[model samples]
Target: MTIFTANPHLLSTLAPFICFIVTVICLLTSIKIMRRYRHKQVFIILICGLGTAAIPQLLNAYAASSLQAVPESLYIISTIAGTISFIIINFVFMKMYAIGIRIRIAPILLLSLGAAIAIAASFLLAPYEIGGTKALGFPVLDFYMFILIITMLVVTRHIEMPAAYFISLCVMFSYQIALMLHQYVFEHSQPWLGALVMALPVLYYFLLFYLLLEWIMERLLTTYQSAILDGLTGLYVRRHFQKKLAEMIARKPAAVIFCDIDNFKSLNDTKGHHAADQALQQVASILRDEVAPHGIAGRYGGEELLGAIEIDKVKPQTIAERIRARVEQETIVTVSVGFCTTKESAELASLVKLADEAMYYSKSTGKNKVTSYRSIPAAYKNKA
Candidate 1:
């Protein structure tokens, strides 16, 4: 056993420097998770957990070395904080991604009580000797290891995890278990590298940071998409659709179809608003089916839908007829559609005006009809 008895310069600087780096990384990641997801209490708990383990690592670094070990008191206290924080993180992850997992207080109470009892045992069982030298906190370390490995297994097994996460976690926990077991065997039997092995759990801590970052990115993307998309109809809102339409107009020759439900107000009055909403959704579904592969469909207003497409690729009349046939066939309602394709008119407002005029012409003559702006009479054009 080659152990440096004098001031071990390399060991001293390398160990603490590594722990410091881990602390900073954990703190920075937690802060980002905190600021972006401030509304979530899990982030607060996560930050606290990360800091709890990190702050104690500086003390732990000193505890490591060739000749001396960290005080048992400092060691056990740090372990307790870290163990509890890990449990909280486990709980929150279960709550977040584990569908149908029980969140009742029983599991938490059981785990906390178990950890507390084990930690206290470390305190009560102290002042012992390992290999004829004064030692402490080893049993507590061992027990805590048991609790963590088993708990992580139970957590990931009972709940569903994404395949990548599950595999990554499995690899991480495997390394933790392997390192701890090596420490347990060699702590009493031989001169060990206390500083390096003891600090390896921080490597696992970094993996936790990775998981949190991935979750936050997924959450932000979902939120942004929800903002632009309508929850009820799964269509783009007017503002986003308008923005996209302008972009499309700039790219190629574009056309638009504007449609409104026929006798929508009467249907709402007679069949109740529920049926009216179903009718609108049905019309949206129909429009959505045809307006794709170079097109967009959106809710222009209540009971109104607008479909936009590239005139060079897709004929405007094709989408309008598909929607008309589908709505009349599938639902108890019908639509009045007006399609406008103008190479000369480039502005969105002008296109909408021409479409809306033709749509109103259908409503005036009779319901359940499709009209093109080119088909409207000169007198009606003057009125329009």
Candidate 2:
């Protein structure tokens, strides 16, 4: 506290300088993300907001550092620019949320633009000189901020929001309150209060930066998931499954279970693709759930699912049977399950082939049953 008061001019100059630097960093980062991610329009608005906000900091820094008195008109311009920047930044937040929830934002945009224009015009048209130790438009800015906080609260109350978003809103509310107090109550009397007012924007911008990073990480994760997982069944795709199976076998003896839905083509032809897809999804879900703890489950192809389990952890035959029973009991269609353990063949291709042969045996003999590659009769297994 003493340090803040000891060098009020230095603290004031440093605070705005730091804020300007932070704003520029955030602006550059936003532009980079926008270009890299190709979110041109949203980032453009954000850049504009940051750019507007930076102006006041620049002006404040110059005013604090300069020996001569800065013109009142310049201070007026800074205040108006800062206010408009706040409006734009809040509008960007609302617009992002609206886009996410599929709500129309054109009305919000128009209203925000109108408010910004009105604030600017009102401040400019009013005849006010910088009276001794008095600032201009404190009441107008305070009223404007009050309205914004209330509107934002209403928006947040109705919609579900992330913790970061809620925290950012809280920061914004605190900033507005601090700003009002500093302008009216303290009137630059307390150095600590001035420091706090300047620092809050840095915190708010930092939170915004964190939010942007979170968004980028989420997008990357989504892209990776889509690449490795089946879009319909939520199981691993064939290529990724094979890669996982290879890794699993390299470590320990494993089992590969192949499951094909019984009469899937007939189901598709008779009940339509929708019914067929539902059956596939149901069967895949059962396979995925049952095998999840022990190992991996994936969609090998249409109506064909595969599961690989480390035999030391769980019995593949038991899992295969459970999958068959679940499909029969829970779904409109049943599955023929066949599994081959690594004891039979260590090669990946051979294990898959043996599992396929066993699945065919179950299919040809009866539908809705499980078959072990080791249990198939020699005569049936040898049949070309």
Candidate 3:
């Protein structure tokens, strides 16, 4: 509070150093994200924009701290660089919103045009002299801010933007309007006003950092889901399902149910791969829905689905019969279903093999019926 109430000149002098630190932090974070994520275009653009934005702040900090007089040409160059960097940062926001279109040449052209305009504006606009202090002003930046707000509003109408990003944009827009009012309408440089102006950028950068982290987390989650789930049936892949089954058997009494589509090869040969794939998906969907409450289901292999359930929760034979009946009634093909309870064999491999043997017996005997390992005769089991 005291700092805000102190001499406006002192606060204004410290603003550059504070802004420089924040920009460098954001630039470093973008670089780290790029290195870890294989150099995404958004991270690269953020790094470039932040790096450019940092230059003017560094120059201003140096000029303010130095005892010797700084050259007017250096000040002009800093002003032009700051204006151009602002344009680049605005373009970054636009790029984020319109991700479907790859904007390669427009940004480069806009940067070049912005540089020319900024250079001309710096010379054409006279310096603002207030309270015996001279400050360089760029009226063009205010106009640019107005255009940016309008463009962003239009872009947001067509594209969905994250809440954090929209909030950051609103903060920047409000700050720009307030800063314009302070500089042009009221024409005052009060200590509180200067401090308010300097503090808003830090908040904006923090929001930007959070938005990037959210995006990275979403990508990681999507990749993880893709790795564990089957692409065609949306069931767990064989390896992950086995791992889950092992854990389940270790905890309590469980049963393994194996299902194989009947006449899958014949269907594939006559009806084509597309039709066969549809049948597999339909059967998998039925297994997934029926078994999800009591256990887990997976794609064991081509046209083969596997499930594991705790015996305490529900009967495995009932679930298997439901799956078989559903496939027979709803899909273009039938399934031979078999199940082995933990009472028979608790070991994961043995349980799966026994269930598969029972399924094979069903396939050989009938084709669309369900078989429990306990129901098989001792002679047949001995032969198996």
Location of the lowest summed lDDT over 10 successive residues in candidate 2 = 1-10
lDDT of 3 by residue, 1-384 (tens): 001112336655676677788788778877887888763886687787788778777776676466333466666666556656666665665565456645475765676576567557745775544334454445675566556666666667666667887787777777677676666665555546666666676577667667767776777788998999999999999999999999999999999999999999999999999999999999999999999888899999999999888889689888999999999999999999999999999899999999998999899998999999999888999998
What's the ranking of the predictions by TM-score, best on top?
A: 2, 3, 1
lDDT of 1 by residue, 1-384 (tens): 011112355554455546556656867777876776654566676566567666556554554443366566665676666666566666766666676764555765677677778767766876334445554434664556565766677658756775545654565465455544444456434224454443455455555666776777888888998988887788899899989989988898888888999999999999998989888888898888888776999988898889999988678887788888889999999999998876737898898778888888887889688898888999989966
TM-score of every prediction relative to native: 0.78, 0.86, 0.82
Off by over 4 Å in 1: 1-23, 32-41, 59-68, 95-110, 123-137, 144-176, 185-203, 270-275
Candidate 1 global CA lDDT score: 0.70
**Candidates' lDDT values, in order?**
0.70, 0.76, 0.76
Deviation from native of the Cα of residue 237 in model 2, angstroms: 0.8
- Residue-level lDDT tens digits of model 2 in 1-384: 001111346556677677778778878877887787665777788888889888887776665566334466666566667766766666666556444653235754665565556556656776322224434544555566667777877877777555787787788788777766765676667667777776776677677777666766877898999999999999999999999999999999999999999999999999999999988988888998999888999998888899999989688888998999988899999888899999999898899999999898899997788999999999988883
List pairs with backbone clashes in candidate 1: none
Q: Give the TM-score of candidate 1.
A: 0.78
